[model samples]
Target: MITDTNHLTSLREQFAALRAQGLRARDAARKLALSEGDVMAAHAANQMHPDVAEHSLYTTMPLDSDWVNLLQGLENCGPVMALTRNDSVVHEKIGVYRNVSATGLMGLALGPEIDLRLFLSKWHAGFHVVEHTPKGEQHSLQFFDAHGRAVHKVHARPQTDLNALEALVQRHARPEARPVFMPGSPLRPPILADDRIDAPGLREAWSAMNDTHQFFTLLRKFEVDRAQSFRLMEGVHTRRTPLVSVQWLLEAAAGTGLPIMVFAGNEGCLQIHTGAVHRIEVMGPWLNVLDEGFNLHLRHDHVAESWLVTKPTVDGPVTSIELFDEQGQVIAMFFGERKPGKPELPAWRALAHQLAQGPVTVAQTEAA
Candidate 1:
């Protein structure tokens, strides 16, 4: 799903035109080579729950099966160790760490904040404290194993506390004798504006969605940008219009009746459902089949924005740098891997800059 700006732009227009032609969802999907199931899901979800349909379709996916955690009780819970791309953070657990899901991936669930820094690279017997900085737009960190193998990571900010974060990962765990602190982030979502999930709209959309596919479509439509872009993909061209951003994405997901699975990169992506927003679990880089999850890209009319993330290679430094969109769409592929001698400016910042390129001038309007 690596799309250049031109390709994305064309896709948007194509989707809009197809929709205008009153083509069936199947036709448009076929034209786009997208999953007819996905579109049908979106369409059906929209019909059933028009109000919150977008949110649901874009964010939720329930656990396919039961996740049984091996660790139990307060002992399993401890300090939450966080490793972001830029820095690391820690949180102490005031409560029990219920093993929900780690970075949205299922498998191991346990309560307790394990020091990812400790076990990420090598088995250090002594304790150490690592300071994480957020100054230069640094947002995430990855953890490595004793053999210098990268295993865990976290995206910082949204202001997560140690305890709160620890609780999130501690609850879900696999039965391992020694509890190694892993890197994690707290789910501190941003606030939302009124339009994202209108209370009334959520209620309305909830009732409308007849099936899961429809639910996802509506949810997918929650973001003004994503929706518009999606419409553009279906062939709706919202050239330079103010589209939804990540803030809106979260709010819509939270307020809507549907669940969400965030297929994210440097930015974000969500697979919505009728229940809750599920975080897609990252099993690591070698798990390429679903490794990158799903990809989505939006670029300026001209510039090909580079979206970057730390990609893991089978054998190399902790990670390799790669780029993708909110939807996991790889835009630019950087092969040869190297750990930056110095922290290079993150690719997400570049994306932020590119996405911000617009005609909006905040210069001269007099307030009434």
Candidate 2:
């Protein structure tokens, strides 16, 4: 928590100036050499000063720490936008918050429209933010990790129930509370050499998988990094693909009207998009999917590696296109849409094979 009045005032001035220059909060905070949470916390503290309050562009109210209950309360807010992102991707889905439940620190939102895997343990601070925009006031619930990185955000839509939202806010608002943030921890080093891992045992375990979910257990059982596991089982179940694989995959899916699943998340929240994508566009380094109720922005330049992975499941072989960054962290994953009792879509499998073969000339790149 930043308690120095002068420092908070300076941050507000600089933040406001940057906002005026048309920089989003995340970029603006990065430009100011601070975490987005720190900047917001400063503004939250500034609200107490009448002089500062009058000139601020946004106001934040710290919320109570009952993350699960607060999320459950959001069900009253009809259609809302759920956003989750990492350094390389931004995933936005619009739907109601339903089937929201949690056990301990793990949670899930399994609504058909809004699906999420929540790790509440990393959820540290939350705020109800109201920003004054030219169009009107924009309201959102934003949550962050202990390191101040954003985990998830829920934005109100035009169809949202304003009264219920307001009531929920009033019920959970902790106006007098202070939110503190710590600096981010250092990044983990690269994975160990393949020679040091149990190659035969890892391959045997990979071959015996009965469900896609078991992959995580395999990684833990072998104490191997995800990418390293792929490297160890490259020939048997994993195959490296070109960096253009993602671009080709999205374009192909859009062209064939294929319904696919896209997964992207940070440490605190995993957001999934399921359905066909129609419009695909590229601007500079970003490859985007702009569709009704869903929007994906991916940094094509950050794709340090791509792979085609197949996991044996009771239903059949489940295939996915996995992307990773230079630091070996997963950027995003792509798969053919299918239910638990169903086999992988043959057409989707063919497309994955094409991606594995090599990159193709992108059919279109112009923004729609």
Candidate 3:
């Protein structure tokens, strides 16, 4: 964190100027060569001089490091928006946080509206933020990783219980606490050579798998990267698709009125959206789903690879459209909506098949 009074002041001034130009916080921070968390931390109440008032743009109160309890408290703030995103996509759902439970550092939120898989260990710091937006006061709880990258966020909606939110903040706020952040780790090295992998054994394990949850175990057992595994089983279970496949899939689902599941996340959280998608819009490079309860903004240009993947389960074969970035990090995943013990939807299977067989015109790739 930049703690020097002179440096902090300079950062604030520059950030304010960028904000005046209508740049979002994340973009403004990046323009100043800083992470959003770094900028937020610099503006925290604890970091300010005792005689100075909070920053006019926003006020941030550091929250206690007890992530599990803080999140559980969100249950009282009904009908809030949960946001999770990676470099290529943003996933937002409006719902109440409910049934939050944690075992050690891993947690789960099983509410019908807010479904999340939480990796609490990556959650390094949190803050209760109140931004003075043009409309009015905007309240949110933002969590960040050790590298100052955001993991997840919850924003108050019109129906949210403001008193409960305020009480939760007051209970968890640590005005004197100073959160420290470290530089991000370097990029990982490329995957190992394929000759060293146990292809035959991997195939045997994949074929014998009884549940999709065991896919991670299979990867570990074979010591293969995810994309590599798919390449190895290309003809049997995986098919490489054009980048435009994602756009085509979404449009087809919307036209057919098929309910689907969309999964997108960063290292700290996995958020899922299930049901039908009605509104589909495109703006420049972004493909957006502007629905009432759910919204997805995906930067299709960032997609370096797309795959039609199939995994075996007790119920039947489940299919998904998975997208990856240039660094081989998963950008997002799509599946047909189905519950446990239920077979895969026939419409979804057909859609996946159609995606694989669809023609990839030069115009389609260029448009995407």
Worst 10 residues of 1 by lDDT: 84-93
* Residue lDDT tens for model 1, 139-217: 2223222222223333333343545434534343221212122223323334344355444444355345443235346
What is the Cα-based TM-score of model 1? Answer: 0.22
Report the lDDT tens digits of candidate 3 across residue range 1-368: 68788888888889888999999788898899888888888878767765553445777899998888898999987899999998889999999899999999989998887899999989999999888777988999999988888999999999999999999999999988788877654366568788988888988888888799899999987889988888888888889888888888888778777889999999899999999898989999999999998999999999998899999889999999899998888999999999999998888887776688775333333333
Model 2 spans > 4 angstroms off: 45-47, 360-368
Q: Note the Cα lDDT for every prediction shown.
A: 0.28, 0.89, 0.87
What is the C-alpha lDDT profile of model 2 across 200-272, one tens digit per residue?
A: 9999888999999999999988889998888878989999999988988898788768899999998899999
What TM-score does candidate 2 reach? 0.95
TM-score order, best first, reads 2, 3, 1
Clashing pairs in 3: none
- Each model's Cα RMSD: 23.9, 3.1, 3.5
Task: Please give the distance, in angstroms, between residue 331's alpha carbon in candidate 3 and its true position after superposition.
Answer: 0.6
Runs of candidate 3 exceeding 4 Å displacement: 49-55, 359-368
- Cα lDDT over the full model 3: 0.87
